[model samples]
Target: MLRMLFHPKSLKFLACIALAALTFSSSCKTVESSSGSLSEKSRTKTDVFFAEMYKKYNPYPIQDDPETPDDCQSLFKEADPSVPYKGVVVYFHGFTACPQQFYEFAQIMAKKGYSALAVLMPGQGRFPAPFNNDGKKTINGRKYKDYYSEYLPVKKGDDWKRYLNFVSDVNTFAATLPGEKLVTGLSVGGQLAAYAYVERPGLYKRALLISSYLGMPGSYSGRNSTTSGGMLNSLRRLSGDTIYHITKAVSQQGSNLDIIADREVSWGDKCYQQTRGFNGNPGRRGICDFHVENIAAINSLGEYILGQIKASPALTQIPQIQYVGPEWDTGGDTLLVRKAIGYQKARFGDDKVNACFFPNVVPHSMFARKDIAVLPETPWINSFMLETTKFLETGATYKVSQEPSEETQWDGASDQDSGVFQNRCDVYAVDYSKVSP
Candidate 1:
């Protein structure tokens, strides 16, 4: 009787009811400024358009920190006003990252005669409020309970739907630009770019997905810690649930997943130039510490997209795709990314799908800043930008190569062996010999 009563469908319905109740209760207690809607405005009027964008997307004040860096905000780079732009290029930064992550690249694209917009992802670029039992307090002119935090300000399912909707909005805005549309994104942003392309076939002329988030490895060498993916996926398969039940089991009632809520954020400069104290960076821009629920949400999107690709016989309508996989990526499951791309290549052939794998020394946030990426001797970043420009123009990939590190090894069978042990080798061996950079 209990099993029948608590059937998966029943449980989901109950969860929805519970969530709705929580929402109603919280809305009564929480005070927040409305994220104003963008009125249909002329894109040519840059100031009006951007002001509306800021109001709509980044409305919440950074609690206790009034000033936010310009780089961290949604940014737009225009080509020479005199010259007609070839197209518009949209860039999405990694999860927890600000638009600053792609500012430089956006500028590059702009210089190459493409209007570039680096969009700030939802729930980013705002600082979280300090923990408090009562969900009401004013801090830095914003309601504390309304702010995003691990201690629970607000959460709705995996939050993938919100993200997808945001993507659609951004693309719709970009569609108004003067020319053909192109997009590039890193990490979770890369996954969103894929979603944008897949959701609206032929909407983009080309897509560049770099280190797309699919899954995380069991451990991270940088953090010297085991990740939740290993344990979470194990539970997911066992429970045959979409990760929600496992989150519910681990988290307290009303908080689906806050396993690392108490863990002190130790991002220290990886997130920004400084980390003085607990939420004390006066100019802090992006989220440094996020809930495990965030990870589960992103992974769910990845799984859904992968399933969509697998289910389709052929995605012929989608334009050319350029996939950039890091040889050594700790942020996401590179193996899964490669496997998914392999599926696409098999279905559409080599002409439609292209991939490039960077070396092991490079960090997952390689494109963010020079200080962040422990780069090779080669000017790989510059070469990469040039290659991207070439691709946008001609749908061609340039050859970039150097001998693999002596310590690199590829003797592996399992995904783990192939992922961590391959040591940055391009396992799929997408031929890069066709053109020299």
Candidate 2:
């Protein structure tokens, strides 16, 4: 009877039971796992910082925005503080978008035993309003019916400084947590993530960039004109200047065409219609309109990152980096995608950096919502999340060399073109041959 009790199978069974109990106890100890709260000191500091910054910039009544919370303009801490975290991701949303853009992604990270903090960029996440810099009018000066007509109070250099400070503060808080540190962003946020990784070498273990707004593709000249003109309109408002120079140039060409009309032609129609949220409903939020000032800021930030890459080639030090670009993204250009991949390859070598393109995905805000379905040919968000976690935990790299066939390309291919589409998306990887400097 003693020999039977001490059998190998019996010992193995007992070990399994013990492990299960240990896991259960650890999970039970986690408090506020879904909505992790920051310490009192951190919250106070965040509030004070934003309060002072808003006053300096044209103060928009951010508290009044229906979408924003009264206490904070951002969401932070998505994991249990008491439990040991697997990793921490500092996620930044896209230009003109709120922290809600990263809400679903943060939830996924928390579920996977990681912590996530989604930081709201300066002057974003609030109701769009035009500001008068002279202080003659209220911060929420005029309420316009159309979003395009609204102007954001953006001090170019000052705003970027505030953004950098916010990112640094969040990084400092993330350091207190017991886990690896990671940074990720979308579009302009992607540019900021790259900037953060470059600025602080060895601080972030991994970085993920989605459709960084480095620059538009060469073929998007027409679209670029409309976007650039719109951005200039916002700048004109804050500077209290007119587009007289541009108007004069157009007049000198022997045409009586209205320059302002030409700039406003594609005001609210530039971005592709998102499939989810208020923007999806034509009667509700209409289309996801791009803010003029926000676009300008994004372009400026992208330029800064490129300049940094050129200035300090050897300072890039993140261990693992992954860049995801959409094959059909209308908001960000494909040329910018190649530039992002090339920059990483140049700095971190081919082994540490990886890139992938979603075959039919077009929306710039691809991963904004959790319920939205991924392109049938691309891997699901869960797969991406798992892979991200794996990289953060083990520094594992997934490199795919399989060349996509012509049928796999997005050139009007039918859904039934190949069996590869039917199978689960292989691990996300970067194909170096596809990228060009």
Candidate 3:
């Protein structure tokens, strides 16, 4: 029995366990040392201000992880700490993405005299300890984990509150800084920024929403594209208690163990990249995989905000929002964002909402370095940033494109009657009444 217990296979298993233990121990010590040095080297006013919020929100004790580099973590750029800050621009990144998405814009804003902050949302970044059944799950007697990335801690039930609370915390942090507080975001982050502006009337000085996820795409849902609120309307009417209980129970799960097993059946394939990496954002640092249930939770938050907007009697504050995106987002985001903008316009007047949808050249989330690669025909990215920076500073209206060439000869053509790169590269004059529900 003793010889059998110490068989070759058993010894090999023990050896593997020993090696893993040693590696984990070394990793811990390295993390501790690196964290100490980082704190001493670059602790700033922004870091000091957000320390409390980090403690309050982040599940893991440490901020940086081996998987998540310092550049991709919560970022703040204040060009001159000694000099007074003119204003602050708060950035919220898209779902499954980190603060790095807005790093370039934040740095630009900082150099332009306004301080900028890109927040790291909760359940993002790598956790210190192993989680989600240690990234393995058993399905039909077989076990597997996502090959591309590890399982993130974002859950289906409480993520709604977590996301909202993150917004609230960021707002509170921004309130402490000097000058005007401007908000901007991309995708789901865009929705959060809009929610913040709507919920806290007169709080933000201006807002920019890029490729905002206002509704589910037909390709993903296997149904017609519908606004988040509309989707909730159907789920509330049809799913009733069953859906509610399932979501609630899933939320209560301590780990993503069950979600891992259900991935193939419910969530479908995990998207590794949004664009084909040729002319669009060539790379991303955020999680490539997500649970569909968590997406539902995000949509619910959007739905709640839409309900609030529709029910409000009147809009307050200055007309200071710019919506920018690609011309024809097949995911149906553009149309729904247009509709949301329409609703706000009907309620708040035309001057409150502004938009610019680039023609065929650009793609979704068109901000990364590679996405904006300086090609002969695509010098518009730099122009877009310059104009955006100008708008943030002076509240002047701006477009994503430069003046159309004589060859294009297009001037404010309708979406239908437009050629490639000529689809209203100017102020979007959307008729609020015609924008369907």
Top lDDT: which candidate number?
1
The most accurate candidate by TM-score is 1
- Candidate 3: list runs displaced more than 4 Å: 1-45, 61-70, 81-84, 127-159, 219-283, 313-315, 330-332, 370-379, 400-423, 426-437
Q: Kindly list the per-residue Cα lDDT of model 3 for residues 265-284, writing each as its tens digit.
A: 12112222221133332333
Q: Please, what are the lDDT tens digits per residue for candidate 2 over residues 253-355?
A: 3124332323321222222222122332211111133323334444555656777765676574665887765543455554555555666566657777776
Query: What digit string (tens of lDDT, one per residue) describes model 1 on residues 1-437?
Result: 13223555455434433433443111110111112221224333444444454454555432222222233446666664554558878888887666767766665565556777776676665533233223333445644323344322223354456667678777777777778899889888888898887777778999988878766432221221134332223223222343334343333332444553222222333343332223432332455554545555566667777876656544456678888756546567666676677667667676787766676455666656523532334345555655666787668874544544221343232334332222232322222332122
C-alpha local distance difference test of each model: 0.54, 0.47, 0.53
Name the lDDT value of residue 236 in candidate 1. 32
Q: How accurate is candidate 2 locally (lDDT)?
A: 0.47
Decide which is better by lDDT, 2 or 3. 3
Give TM per candidate. Answer: 0.66, 0.60, 0.62
Report how far off residue 346 is in candidate 3 (Å): 1.4
For candidate 3, which ten residues in a row score worst on lDDT?
25-34
Q: In candidate 1, which residue ranges exceed 4 Å CA deviation? A: 1-57, 62-70, 127-158, 218-284, 312-316, 370-379, 402-411, 415-437
